[model samples]
Target: MRHRVGPRHARRPAPTLLRGIYLPRSMDAGAHAMTTFGIPLLVLATTNSAVLTGVAFALEWVPRLAAFALAGAMVDRYGASPVFRTASVLRALTVVAAALALPYSDGVGATVTVMLLAASTGVLSEFSYIAAETAGGAASRAAGSRAHRVQSVLLGIDQVGTLAGPALAGLLLERYGATGMLTVIAGFSLLAGLLAPRQRDGRAAGLPEPVMKGLRTGWSTMRSLPTLCWLVVGLTLSNLAVGLLQAAAPVIVIQHMGRSSADVGMIWSVAAVATLVAVALWRRAIDRYGLWPVGAVAAAIAATTCLAVTLTHTYTTYLVLIAVLMAAEGGMTVMLRTLRSHLIPASAFGSTLALSALILLAPFPVAGVLIAVTPPALLVHVMTGCAVLQAVGLAVTFARLRAAPGLRTALA
Candidate 1:
């Protein structure tokens, strides 16, 4: 009886801890996705301007990038649970406030209000995300040899949220309106806040340092890892094409293709399924072929699909190409996560992760600006140029990665 009881008690913490993190993270991720997709669509719906939609997209990503370092520092000082819950609650309240104020706002005032909401929520979402990531990192570190398995589960949960949020947001926006959509998003945020688990010690390692200091540590860490640097460069280039397409999606579907918001959401929802399948395959493929070979294939597929997507005029072709492109993106993402878990030392993991995220996210605002300035008809040409660059860049990067000694030793 004592032996059985002791063994059962020892096994209980892992599943319970995972649930405490995974459940709230799922809710938080879904709310974040809804806000991301919904806000740009909202801007388009309200202003009937592609430029404003682009601006809204920039507003969302820029602040999110800016907040990463600070959020990492805060999570280190205050612990993950408190920071996550606070950010979640703040996001919910902010969304609710925006929903209430939108109806009372005048023409320009309404636009300004929405823009403010986008920026604020973007910052808050980053805070919650970083905290959640920190918690997950702690759990992974605890798992020791099974860290990759834990990360795979977390990635799958993120994909599930991505699957549900955009389609639901589009439907609600089409049927009900911005207010209804915002309310639902707020509910999810509130749930995330309520579901946060208490940290065991309620604090992290050291006293909080400046964001710049964190960046310096992260930057130094990146320099030590040449493979990670090259991969970042390739991913950054790929993201430019991906980001541009995402920013221009509403305009392309609704204005150019004469489709509805639901169609816009459907594109992403379907693509997410392909991504999920790709992620699953990536897990198995990595074991048989190793990282470099699998990653090279993914990069090739992504590049080819992006190039093909530029020539697509029909909605069906566009959707299919985007799905394939996203599938490739998903595979590459798994490779990156696996590499990150293995390469980045546990001591600097949070700051380095935040830094890497910031670098990757740098392309989104640039894509937003391109969308704002470029003619909608010529956006395809821009995509073609970006796709060509991505292909070349990824090809070169992977060639180096295949030859890199550091990566070879790490894999060994």
Candidate 2:
């Protein structure tokens, strides 16, 4: 059933190439962007409620958080690439199921069921996402001096997807409604699934450890590194602030600004451009100026931009400021990701990154809860306080990290 190639004919190593498995992973991210952005609009359209929209947004993340430990264990025990393939198929199936349920989405019960089902898909998608990212990190490392450059390319691909996906979703939802848009998302998921298994990372091998054994190894790895542990804590706090933007941005853009879903699309499209520019400049800036200095400056910029969000009620200001704020966040994201790649051993990449991600993202739902309860007028002030807190925290933490004896040698 199988044909063997002669010595004269050999296949190129796609996994060692610049694009590699990261390309499909980026496409999958786009599918994620589509569903995540579409969910709030879909819920708001059906229920005519901002609170429900926030709840729907929160649902997407909750199950993913719940599944992180297991997802990591699975990826580590069985290999990241295969886990990614399985997750992609599951994502495609769920997207199809959710698409089929669209007609009944008008009722509260139906909407709730659909939202929860979407969350289940999110759980699987997160597994695939982590696997892809871990593989991407490996590919970039293999690329040598151009590692950051290759990573920038990958990040650009992801941003392109993130940018186009929501806008396309918005356009599709407006033109054809939820069913048509969901169909598109399902197609993306399916395509990602099909493409994933073609590329294999020689580096993504599984340990012989059982799930709990793997988890304990990852935990030990995380705890043994003081700076990495600090990074997880600091980044998690930073995400608490980021959670506000994620949960409330849609409400602000649509409900408060009196804008359409198309406006949300435009906002992120601009942000995507900003993200590309930021990623391009960030590594070079870090090389010249040092990571701590550049990160501090980025943190200051992000803090200033976020706090500025409270200064005006204008839709244009919110769009521009949020886009700029996200740009700064994008740079910081790459910086942190680089650190993770450098710090975590390849054997523990899946599990450690999973635990780290769980810690970082848990605040999103909390932000959703706050958005539901906090008065709209006071929301801006709360976000401003969070931004200020994050900025100050970043400054203090980075300073301490740099000053710590042996930290530089260890990182080196």
Best by lDDT: 1
Model 1 TM-score relative to the real fold: 0.92
| Tens digits of lDDT, candidate 1, 318-400 | 99999999989887887777677767876777688889889988999899889999986788889899989989989998998
Provide the clash count, candidate 1: 0
Q: Estimate each model's TM-score.
A: 0.92, 0.90
The residue-by-residue lDDT of candidate 2 on 285-346, one tens digit each, is 76565556666667778777877876768888877897888788776676667667667888
Residue 129 miss distance in model 1 (angstroms)? 1.8
Candidate 2's TM-score: 0.90
- Clashing pairs for model 2 are none
What are the lDDT scores of the predictions, listed in order? 0.85, 0.74
Best-performing candidate as measured by TM-score:
1
